[model samples]
Target: ILSAVDTFGFHLNALDLRQNSESFEAVLDELFAAAGVTAPDAGYASLDESAKRELLVAELTSARPLVFPWSQDFSADTERELGIFRAAAQAVELLGPGVVPHCIVSMTGTVSDILEPMVLLKEVGIISFNPAQQRLVGSVDIAPLFETIEDLKAGAEILQELWEVDLYRGYLRGREDVQEVVLGYSDSNKDGGYLSANWALYDAQLAIVKACDTHGIGLRFSHGRGGAVGRGGGPTYDAILAQPEGAVRGSVRITEQGEVISARYGTASTARRHLEAFVAGTLEASLLDTESLKEPERAYGIMRDIASLAGEKYAQLVRDDSGFIDYFTQSTPLHEIGDLNMGSRPTARKQTESIGDLRAIPWVLSWSQSRVNLPGWFGVGTGIMRWAGEDETRWQDLRKLYQAWPFFRSVLDNMAQVMGKASMNLAQIYSTLVDDPTVSQRVFNTILDEYELTKEVFFRITGHDSLMAGNERLERSVQRRYPYLLPLNAIQIELLRRYRAGEDTFLVSKTIQVTMNGLATGLRTSG
Candidate 1:
């Protein structure tokens, strides 16, 4: 806490309290009932976006409080959430502005989702309209986190709608016309694949930029990146530079979690290096027009094609294949990983076979443990192959694009690093753990085929015969780690075999857990 205060002053790190938008709606429903008044237009949930916006605008524009201390009748969860907002209001009075700068609503799909939190903030006295001044007063920014691919695609439309409302437009003026939107890297990647996720995010940002421009709003993007490629992890500097033009817009935020936090900030010198890289990258992205060389429309079209083809291929293997779940459970240390307790967040959103329920960290970590790193490179090869085919000209165009486009270059480079670290032989060994030989062979063969194709495509684009060819230092460093990783992989496979064969003992489970940690450390990635 002291360190945070020292670095960021009394406001500290500016906590962003997040919850599902539905939860906020439920809270508002209870609040309405407790106040003994019908909602402005029926119940909050039943109201359409236009009604909700109109109601919210009326409430925010009034000086009257929605809920008072005497009327604080609500369920335990609702009360707790309200108490948090009330505390935040108090904190602003005590610690000054910036203590809690944002209340992020996750799974935000509609204008109502954004307005729901704003109403709660008004109830807590964090936001109010001044009739004399004709403006809203508030310190916290209510950011909507768009997670799934569908949400990302619709992000611009949602923001545009929010800005169109006269009341919300006035509120934006109070915020100096600045709006923050969070894009979820992990969820989208899990929903689609790496290529589709990247393309969706890029297109979303482009559309959002245009929307913000049209509304005369300053846009700030918060990237929900994780410590794996599937979760938008890569060299921080390159990643920032690779963002869609105007996406950075002088300010940006990204989540650094798990091993990434430690790896970047564990030491003073390392932290300095990482911070310097971030600052430099941000400045370059904000000031420089990196998209001049490539035609934006042309690039977008190519990426769209690639993402569509790649996403389909990825869905075929992971989603369409019924035996994939069994293969994943057997081939990787997913079950053991849960017991490792590496994080406070639940491994799965719910108990289900659906990939959407599984968090991205474990998704990529599982693949990393098996030495396949499938999440990073799976559908990319197929996508490239389908696009290029036997056309030498198309292949040449890709190489030129890789050279000129920061986004394309970064994607290929990151994939190369992940692919270089993968061990097909080790991956094959893990495939044996699958119960049925036919299923195992079928999936494994597909993976192997894709892996080979990915390598071929990567080399073709990079003009290199081998992975990490130009960066010998990094290549050597990764190569050195591979031999050490083999023992842990071997141990993990044996332990998985024993444990799955009904030897589910404490020691066996513990060993498998330890091996998982070792592999993640050695690989410098977590799912």
Candidate 2:
């Protein structure tokens, strides 16, 4: 227990206080209003980008904070948020900087979004600017989480614009010129599908690196990965090594979600192994010149073609086909999974039927429970087949690329692992939960056909006749666990059947929840 406590820290890992950028802006607007400032009379949201930046810089650089003893007129939500930041400051002061190292602004689109948190931190005395000393004082890193494909594509420009601000530049100088930007894997995947998400993340990192280089600043990336292949889940070592050149200069941060945390760190030995792999991978990525492994120009073209084709196919099934959602919710134990008290975080970002609004954890977890594992490899086969069919030479080129490029190889290998875990026979069983036979048959058939194609392409590319051919230990482990998972899957299907058929008993719900947890454990993955 002491070992566990020590490993997890006083707070069970460094806490990062995060909120949408718009929330921070709202907090600031309240502060400005209480102070009787007319500059924001039209509201901060309506202000143009340049005007917002100017106001933010003025407020952040001022020795006087926006908050005062008389600033008690703010809304309850704003007060709670401010209190959270204040608590973070106090925590840092009491427990040292590691207690809360980051104040992340999610969905950060503009330069002002990055500055809004800094302004809030200054109000709580976590950050201060002294023009006389020509330096800035701060303990926490303000990280911008670029989540959408568009935000990712525009990441470098936003960072460059933020750095050009004199006050922010001073903060960077104080922090040793290192800036940490978080690339959100889950949201981007949800927004643009797997292929598009991967490519956008890579391209964003490359651009951000270039921007940092031009500005003579060191860059660090925080990867927001989940346990499923759809959410940037894969072998961590290979994933790190496959990063674009200069992306992982010396440091990297990744989020191991609750489900993955248990699987990877449930025991001392397992925890140690995972940590060692992370350190080893980071060291190798930092020191090795992986750029020489492949011709990047040629590789980039192939990847673009693959991502385009894959993204279109993914959208056709998930977004274009209206019946897919019904198939997904009915076939998987998604609703029951939400009722499980797995974590403090809410299951969905907002209450909505749209897949885009569904958080990635549940999105991937539901698929894992159903044994379809669609997020990991759904669109990949179509992408490969389309690319290869356009030109016969492309197939040979892909084989050569897989052999030569660690990035390409890692992508296919990770997909193969998820594909290996997928049991179509069991997936067929789950499909029975779908009320309409036509919808179930159509969607399941599409998924099954794609699964076969993915497996075939994956084997051909890797030159392996069987999945996990090189990893005997993993194969053996899977075989041993395979039988145990079948019972849980069977129980889940029955429970789902009864529950959907209007047998909405608490006992039935609880049993379904238990089975969901069991399957997630058996598979060593959740959302």
Candidate 3:
């Protein structure tokens, strides 16, 4: 029933080719130099954005490939980069489109960022420019990954511009004009605080959906989620239902990392249940009007203000506080987390003191290990308090929003769960590790005050005396987990002191690791 041209596998595999935009630029710089397209002194990366865009577009339309598979002129990094796409091409040619679905470029802020991967795919034979028709022949899709808060805000506009490019439009025709967008939660959360990042993501989805509708393009969103609420972790079912209307569109892809994958899908029965929940949630969200708010625009405006206030306060902590880094690195086992090598990527992009460079996983893990869990709920209280200052009507309106708006309810509830797991007591215990007592006490005191304020505001808005009041099962689980966490956290702190104070024995190191494992296990979904 199938011809050679039409036949394709349902899916052999669909692993996305993900790399930072900087890496793409580096590889291009080398390729342009090797090909004599640029002056030896002035490489591709040295060019301005406009010049780079013009060159990349021109390169995509050119008949000749940039890299010659047999050439040894390319730097080691360039060769390895080319080799990856080359292997992807081989897999796709052999297996089908399923082999390499999309090449996800991280930190994509411009049209050229999306085009860089297309050019690379061209060099590797994954794509070929057909001069006769002036179109591109390719099976792979170039998905732009918008990670930071600024990027998310600009994502829809970038996609709109990308679609307007003549060459890119032709390329999209091959894939039936479908575009995949990858949204990064961790960096967005890191850039803004919890409330701000969550709202931005939801708003970005809405904008992207509107843009796609206008362009008549099919869209699929791949969520770069992590295991902590700070990193977009929460109940899968609730998260799905909370998606802005038209966000799901019958297809969704969410990532699970670290212990989360095993916890969610380790056993056959649990896997089936989670699979069922995912399917049920996706279907319900796609078919039904999940976003039920009496005044959608009004709620949106309020949330925007709160997010702005929260972001400002969050900056006061991570960005403004001089002692924050010392408070973070010294108080928690961040250095030790690097040793775990929990994932393919490093804990930070490179050695840097700036919080922006540090990867979200370890940023969250350090906080979780210290029992601070700051990422999940910090700055929200002050934001909410400032907005509803001495106003009972405003507080009542928020309560109504929590009851009626699934998105609002989901956010507040998830934050509540993460906050409930946090321990001020244990956080103080870990604070003792800080070298400067003054820094330790000041930072810890600030955390303590914010913690109380956040809890107070959260309870008032939800009309609940405690966290996860609606979820008896989770509440019971947390209650069960806390006892084990106390002793494990205490032991880990002790071991950490010995480990840091020149007790370099394998016994101390291994025991510390064991404590980390125990803490991570007890506080399920922790970073």
Candidate 4:
């Protein structure tokens, strides 16, 4: 029985329901209108941040349900949103609190953003507020996901402001005075580069830990990591061990989705290994058992400088270059991915061609499929090189930093793992798919140059003879898989060319999809 219990998690992974904050705002807008609540210009969605916070708290203070779900007609979107919450509430009532434990607010930017979902959930009775008793009771946790680089930088400040709200504080007290903060890895990676995103997350954790400590609140970090390095995928043990001290607090939740779920936990042995990693990582992180640098402040300053310079370089290609979108869409299988019935989720949030609108899964997956792995290492070379410059002392400092700082080392090592798997030769072949010679040549050349620079700087800093030098497990994994992956990539390229040139046939599309699934399985972090 004990062995069976260990092998099987009976609803061990709690369902975490998530949606964009805008979805909550829209639902509230419809609900307010239905309830005949009078407000200024735009009802609920148009209120300023402060007003939204106060109004939401006041609404919570009233102990009244905002919606007459049976009586009022709601927009399809609103109904859909309400339907999900209602279903979740019903499930919790029937199956107990373990059925759906969290309602996460994605793209959460403000105090109001965090409160919005709580308000909606209150209307459905998932949470209750007693105005007369000044009490709040919640059946589920409300976790705010901070995704963008800007949002990550402001997370601590937002939390500080949030905890000041008496009602929110009261709600926290009801939930054991704990706050679960989700750090978004994919969006932050796409917004900046690998180095910048990693640094931002680490720095934000340092600040947030301090803030939570000041408030005497228990803090739990739920990492919104994907299966790819660009999406916060790496060696789980190392990644957790590298976190800022006190960030873990013996409780950390790392998301596992798509290929990662299979890659990490497909088999019994692999599953046990990863579970051990999580347990070990938490214990080590909580105990302050990891190594620490003597000059943390100095290392922090150096990292900030590197990340700033690197971010500019990343923006130069991904954000500033107008031709980049065309280059990316043309070269990679991004559009074709949209055609595949991967799941119920769309490839993008909107039909528009904005990078921000493109979900991070597809963005990173596209790059991964093409084998450029651009999101993993782009701009890092420029960041490190430009910051170090011609100063030999600075170069030595970086090498020492990599040796001493767990966070910095993890950043470089993970990049090495991704870069080791990436083949510029294969990427160059994919570049031929681009129509415009100028765009293809310019972008490819820039990528190759950075690849060379990044590899050089990576080896120099780590004092490793080759990429994946110390990581024999990854090296062996790559060696075994590369032979199989290369041919699939080549075939995929030809198939893409044929299909794009109007071959539009069942066989052609089918073959292309076969190669896609094959690569995704082999890459493990493909999507």
Worst 10 residues of 1 by lDDT: 36-45
Give the worst 10-residue stretch by lDDT in candidate 3.
4-13
Give the higher-lDDT candidate: 2 or 3.
3
Candidate 4 lDDT tens digits, 1-527: 78755654354556878999888888887787677664535688877898888888887777567775376677899989988988988877876777688889999899998888888788888888776768778878889999999999999999989889888888888888899999999999988988899999999998999999988999999998988999999889999999988898878998888877877888999999999989999998999757578888898999999999999999999888878888898899988888888866787888736588788888988898899999999999999999998899999999888888788888999898899888899999999999998999999999999999999998778889889997998799889999999999999999999999999999999988888888888887674
Backbone collisions counted per model? 3, 0, 0, 0
Clashing pairs in 3: none
What candidate 3 gets wrong by more than 4 Å, as runs, is: 1-12, 69-72
In order, candidate lDDTs are 0.86, 0.85, 0.88, 0.87
Instruction: Rank candidates, lDDT, best first.
Output: 3, 4, 1, 2
lDDT of candidate 1 over 1-527, digit per residue (tens): 88877778776467777888889988877776667545555676687777767766776776667677687556899988988888888888888777788989998999989988888888777887778878777888889999888999999999988877777778878887899999998888888888888889989999999988876789899999988887889989999999988999888899998899899999999999999999999999999987655577887888899989999999999999998888887788877778877777667878848787787778888899999988888899999999989999988888888988899888888888888889999999999999999999999999999999989989888889888886799898888987888899999999899998999999999889899888889888784
Give the TM-score of each candidate.
0.93, 0.93, 0.96, 0.96
Q: Residue by residue across 205-290, what tens digits does model 2's lDDT show?
A: 98999899999999999999887788998888888988998999878998887678778899999999999999999998899886
What's the C-alpha lDDT at position 317 in model 2?
90
Query: How much does candidate 3 score in TM-score?
Result: 0.96
Best by lDDT: 3
Model 4 segments more than 4 A misplaced: 1-13, 39-41
Tens-digit lDDT track of model 3 for 1-527: 35633554645347789899989989988888888789999999889878988998899888776666575577788878988988898888877767787899999988888888888898878888988999998888888999999999999999999888888989998888889999999999998989989989998998999999999999888899998899999889999999988889898999877777898899999999999999999999899998888778899999999998999989998889999989999999888877773667787887758789798988898898898999999999999999999999999999998888899999899999998888898899999999999999999999999999999998888878888797889999899878777888889899899889999798988888888778878887555
Name the lDDT value of residue 7 in candidate 2. 72
